[model samples]
Target: MSHRIVSKFGYYSLAGFAGSALVQLAVIWPQTWIAVVALGAIALLYFAFLLICIKGVLKGARWAGVLNFNVLGVDAIESTGIVLFFVVGGVWTCLQIL
Candidate 1:
């Protein structure tokens, strides 16, 4: 695959993960100030890292591609796990609320 495509995917994945984390925070703890701040911080850091990765990819750095690929793979796995955990937790919460 072209570096551009890889870079786009990496950027999108990071954004998606940040969005999901924010959503999860809202769902699991709607009124917690600390959760809000922490999730916002995490999202910011992820965006910064994604920008750096994209720049490196555009610059034709071999190590950047390797690092980006590994980070993307790990992010994919982590997101999948987070989604599953939330799905199960949501069901449990609904049952309790009912």
Candidate 2:
């Protein structure tokens, strides 16, 4: 039951992220068509995996929940790394100036 809930949330979040990205790309239009194309390709691949997981969940595959947890875990790690990088960088700069 929890797996189904998480899977549904993942689907909606991924869709929302992709939609917002497209809107942003449209706003920038001509300047970054190359980037838009690259991101679009990557987004398609990401969506494919999510769809596969969705299918697995619907079919009662145990691995689907594991895959979803792994994906979300990696995302959490990546975000934390980014935040730490900036925080440490700023602190290092301040210490150097002192």
Candidate 3:
């Protein structure tokens, strides 16, 4: 689990967000100018976590581990919300048919 907890998923999460921020900006061009700040903030958070882990400047290695898990925790929360929405929507449609 250390591979996932410490290295694999956390690093990928940061990189993925950074990539998405760029894509998000491109997709939201013109009228939605403010999305740059919003998505940039999310992307920066991931990069900051990556920097702290790589730099070894934190008080302890444990804090990096904690932050890594926190990243996963956030991912799970967002995924759960989306999943719950779909589940609720599906049930609502089913109920209407019944």
Give the best candidate by lDDT.
Answer: 1
How do the residues 3-98 of candidate 2 rate in per-residue lDDT, one tens digit apiece? Answer: 986775565555445545544554557565565456556555656665676688777787876763543465744543343443344334334443
Steric clash pairs (candidate 1): none
Candidate 3, 1-98: lDDT as tens digits: 55655664454455444444444444546444355455446545656655565555354565565553443367655543443443344334334433
Alpha-carbon shift of residue 61 in model 3 (angstroms): 3.4
By descending TM-score, how would the candidates be arranged? Answer: 1, 2, 3
Residues 8-83 of candidate 1 have per-residue lDDT tens digits of: 5565556555545555656668775466456556655665776677688778787796872644566655654444
Better of 1 and 3 by TM-score: 1
* Worst window of 10 by summed lDDT in candidate 1: 82-91
What residue pairs are clashing in model 3?
none
Every candidate's lDDT: 0.58, 0.53, 0.49
As for lDDT, the candidate ahead, 1 or 3, is 1
Per-model clash counts, in order, read: 0, 0, 0
Number of clashes in model 3? 0
The predicted structure with the larger lDDT, 1 or 2, is 1
